[model samples]
Target: MTEKNPSQKTVSSRQNIRKWLLIISFLLIPVTIFYISPIVAMMGAGKGIVTSAILLYILLFVVSLVVARLWCGWLCPMGAWQEICSPIFKHTVADGWRNWIKYGVTVLLFAMLAFTFISAGGIHAVDPFFGTVNGISITSFQILMIVVIIFLIIFAAAFFTGRRGFCHVLCPIAGLMVAGRKIRNLIGWPALQLDTAAGHCIDCKKCSNECPMGLDVNGMVRQGDMENADCILCASCADACPKGAITYGWKKK
Candidate 1:
């Protein structure tokens, strides 16, 4: 039997940290769900109020300037839920024309938001607690059912399709972060970005296999480029690299 590489062990340990963090995030969904929900945002917008979700969408874009889709990687309850189901469904989702569908969803969501605000004469108030009862989201049986249905949809996407299938093709919030990250790339800011030392790679393919987003990390490394809109900066490739070929660093490009 081949011995385990120390670097591989280190990466595996790091991934475990991410796993536990995701689990904690998932457990806290009841408290945090409304805050990150676009549905809540639209509801608030219709009543001429700015919701927490609106603020978070803005924050996601702003933070993506420095961190890319770190929220998707480390703290998203839905992402955590999908990963929990990943043990039984370890397939990779495809990034095709369907992947672009989320942008249209984002546009429609925001367009409705804008229309609502306009109909209400624009921003009559700002209430981060607009949709919550004492900042708790699943406050009633109806709400609990909604949450359950949403989670079931997320689970269905992951189960019937592949890992992060919802994220890759259906998530409405990802567009904001992707835009921010792309702008950062254009602006050349020293943000949280990945780097690859192709010379250090040995074609073991562990990085590609470890990528939760189902990216071609091995191909990215071979090309000496780790920049991708879909990359959540989870560092799975970096951690899984037995040769330390992939690494994360704060820099542009």
Candidate 2:
């Protein structure tokens, strides 16, 4: 086997760091569940909706307006889980009209939240650790079951559909991020984005193949349209490209 070059080693080290960071974040999900749980956010302590998840999502959306879904790429436990299972199903999910499903789900979830709040006469209290037991997620058998079922569905979706299938088709949080990204784009704000130099591309499809989100990175590079709402900003394409055709940069201009 040929010895790896220094640049390859550097890229490999960065990829490993990103992977381990995601794994560590995913491992801490049980503790951070209270802050990210949709159920707990939607249904409060038998009174009104919990404010933690809502506040967390709001913060995420604000971040997305500037960074464009970095939360999904770097910190989301569900994204980490799907990536861990990518070896089992490395197929690219077909992106078409089907991608609209997540938006519909987001709308439905918002509608439900609104109805719940209205029924309860608006949010009455704020409990960051609403469903959690002493700030831990899996305290009781019931909570454990709920967590198990959620993971089961996530796993099933990734196993059958493709890489980050649930994120593409089902995650309401993704829809929210997309909305934030769209608003940023419309306003032409300086935001985190993938910058590509199509002239440097050597037709190597490694970037596209290595993309965890299964985006057509090669095509995007060729078209000089590197900004996609679906892009999670993982920078896998940048690392995988040998020619340094792709890069992560802010769209400041």
In terms of lDDT, which candidate is strongest? Answer: 1
Instruction: Please give, for residues 38-152, the per-residue lDDT of candidate 1 as tens digits.
Output: 8899889989999999998998989999999999999899989987877776778776786788788888888899999999899999999888898888889999899999999
Worst 10 residues of 2 by lDDT: 1-10
Regions more than 4 Å wrong, model 1: 1-11
How accurate locally, in lDDT, is each candidate?
0.86, 0.83
Tens-digit lDDT track of model 2 for 35-104: 8877877777336756688888888889888888888888889899988888887788887966788899
* Displacement of the residue 140 alpha carbon in candidate 1, Å: 1.1
TM-score of candidate 2 versus the correct structure, residues matched by position: 0.93
TM-score of 1: 0.94
